[model samples]
Target: MGTYRYRVQTSGFGLFLGIAAEATRLTNPPTMNVPVSNRVWLDASEVNNAFHGNRLALNEREVAWLRVGLDKVSGDIERIETSPYILISVRALEIFEVDYAEEALAPAIAGWATREFTLTPRLCNVSRDSDTGQFTFDWNE
Candidate 1:
């Protein structure tokens, strides 16, 4: 089995904070794992409920990290505008996976982002070189 990684980008820190709080409450006891870097790895089963029916295969192992950052934009007025966004990265381990991130996970996140935060989320496919361990991103698909 191989591991597939994908990323989703969306702008909505305030709304996401509420959503995360609710998710944490709904998860009850909390099945998530948090590292020193403050990255929370969501539980696959709970993710389905939190994301409103984005089904993750139980046979495969799935992990996700949510991070908040700012996007800097320079406008014609010579002012820098900072927008907050959340970056979600998902990793799935399976054999013969078929664009699970593009077809399922991303859509789920996008749906929630749009409905809750009125924000659009962008999905990107990530690939890693076996020998060099370098990562590449494909934003087109």
Candidate 2:
């Protein structure tokens, strides 16, 4: 099976942060690997037409509602074999600290992958080298 990676960007004030923070508090955060009931592939043309230049803003409640809708429409989506990890810059946002955001968003991003691709994703820690000013991913697999 082929592995896929998708990057999702969300504002700091959305439900994504709230849900993700709660999930990170768990000893072993929840993972999803549900099988798709109805197989329906996404049409690239349609997706692009719908979201190409539009900015879709959704709150926590709206996100939950959208998940339900996605579950119904994207049942036939492909599954991810490998556990995808998240990479966030340490200095990305001023309001949200990198350490906290890393902990919160890792599982959140993984959950997103699981929901969309029917696979359990992993949270990998990111480190920056002081000398080289480069970032490295430590896949805690």
Candidate 3:
């Protein structure tokens, strides 16, 4: 009924990847029937690479949800050049919309959506003088 949350597709914070899976790709009711968008190909190799040797920051329910999404993504990419990869953050809103009405899932989904996507500062190295407030940047080539 209100704004949907937990929508970021990349790995950062706001919503843990595992939690996002439960809200979007792994909702028990299967709320997505439309074509998915905003998704990037995520292969098993990449998944392993991302979490290799590290404990996935998800609980059992979240892990199960992630598995559902991974399975769907794996199937979707099979016939395309991007086969063997699954999509993340694809149809985030659509998926959320379908399940947002549920009482138990709504709060968690909303919280995850609150996470912001951040970009590394791209400007050249910078420095400032303490006394004069003068600024300098290397901008070296």
For all candidates in order, the CA lDDT equals 0.29, 0.30, 0.30
Tell me the TM-score of model 3: 0.23
lDDT computed for candidate 3? 0.30
In terms of TM-score, the best-performing candidate is 1
lDDT of 1 by residue, 32-131 (tens): 4332122222333333323344544443322222221101001110121122212222233222232233223322333333333333444545455558
Q: Sort by TM-score, best first.
A: 1, 2, 3
**Candidate 3 worst ten-residue window by lDDT:** 40-49
> How does each model score on TM-score?
0.26, 0.25, 0.23
Relative to the unseen true structure, what is the C-alpha lDDT of residue 11 in candidate 2, on a scale of 0 to 100?
Answer: 38
Runs in model 3 with CA error above 4 Å? 1-56, 82-141
- In TM-score terms, candidate 2 sits at 0.25
For model 2, the local distance difference test gives 0.30
RMSD of 1: 12.9
For model 3, what is the error of residue 128's alpha carbon versus the real structure, in angstroms, after optimal superposition?
55
> How well is each residue in 1-141 modelled by candidate 2, as lDDT tens digits?
122222334332222132211111122212431221222211111111121334334334433432432343232232322222211101111122332323333334334435435554454455555587443445464
Per-residue lDDT for 131 in model 1? 82
